[model samples]
Target: MIVFDLECRRGQHRFEGWFRSSEDFARQEELGLLTCPNCGSADIGKALMAPHVGRKGNQMPVHAPSVPPPAAAPAPTTLPAPAPAAVAAPAVSSTPLPPEAMALMHKLARMQAEALKSSRFVGSSFADDARAMHYGEREAETIHGQTTIEEARELLDEGIAVAPLPFPVVPPEQAN
Candidate 1:
């Protein structure tokens, strides 16, 4: 399975679309079967994505040398931020983001924490609580917790509203 970052041309909204293969994605798009999940618009296209070329079974990854090359420029003062979890760690020179970008990331994390302040921590019960609320078996309220990706997908398939946070959230007890 492969996932592509898809964007709606009309709405400019981005979402992930999972497909069996690149050809599958192209076929769906050609048939107008690929619509923006956000706005339900048929005008959609694959967004620019970082290369995720698969490695051959016996191929090994190449690493960059620690010593600077003769043509290399002077090193910058700042260090690169750690790679996002989705990608493999780099083995070569990495250009770090500017201070403004780092500050924006911190601000975003703070905002997310504030938004989830009142949400209950359900831990392993996340799927159960969400399911209960969706079926009207229990009153709906704010909740945040951990559950497998499979469970989250199942919830969405069942038409239950559930979202994964952009940043990893620490449990309340862990925070305290």
Candidate 2:
């Protein structure tokens, strides 16, 4: 399978599309089957990409010129063939997170867990509960729950201090 970096012209969203081959991708695009997964836009095109080529174990590395050749400098008596563009990014080295990154993630998870301990899980009534707290109808207390994006935006626009949690929590009813 070949992966193409595809972009949606409408939303400018970049995503990868896998096809059997380059010809398969072109055929799909011609048939209007290609689409942007983000916005569902059919106006998809290949995004600009860097070249990728493997180097032989015995091949020597090419050194970049420290300085550009002078414009007035005499031309070389014999010019070598033009070299191809830059190589692709290095391959992923490991699947596991680095020590420092793992540590930070653990710290953030701990903080979130601790914060959730004091917060009430109101489930789908998050926006309503938040509004009640803001209006003093309910006592001001820590709360965390699920709400639609539109509801969350409405809460923020109404000057209610509600922020989404970094991680989702299991509701009391669903948890042991």
Candidate 3:
């Protein structure tokens, strides 16, 4: 026996019925044998069955309570934001020399040491001795010593030839 969902046209009522075959159901339907139990209407036809679309994979049909369709969603909105100026930037100092510059300074220091191999060290009297040489009171010779930028500039302004040492020089007194 086969069961089918049947309906009556006069009352639009749905019901289930059993039959020996599809042909038996059709024959009975043709002979006005099917009737709605609730309405007793013989104007009966097979109800359109909802297509049995099986769930794919591990999915199951969710049996949720009926909820009214949400009202038309409000127009999309944007969040308020602070001005770009109000955002705090990362604190970074611009004064530090990069690794490449520091490496170059070290390389230049080595090169300067090599070039000053024959030069003499005059200790802290660099300014006075340099001035004396400029005035022809002392013999001119290659010399290197510690001097401030201001003192070097002063020497240069006085027409004295003074070039900065590219590296710190070891004082003769300090050399053991």
> Of the candidates shown, which would achieve the greatest lDDT relative to the real structure?
1
Model 3: per-residue Cα lDDT over 19-100, one tens digit each: 7889988887787666667677778777787644558989877898987657796545887553121101233668989999
Error of 3 at 1 (Å): 96
- Stretches > 4 Å off in candidate 2: 1-94
Alpha carbon lDDT at 83, candidate 3: 18
TM-score of each: 0.46, 0.50, 0.39
Selected candidate, larger TM-score, 2 vs 3? 2
Candidates ranked by TM-score: 2, 1, 3
**Order of all candidates by lDDT, from best down to worst?**
1, 2, 3
Q: Clashing residue pairs, candidate 3?
A: none
Best by TM-score: 2
Q: What's the CA error at residue 81 for candidate 2, in Å? A: 22
lDDT against the true structure, each candidate? 0.81, 0.80, 0.75
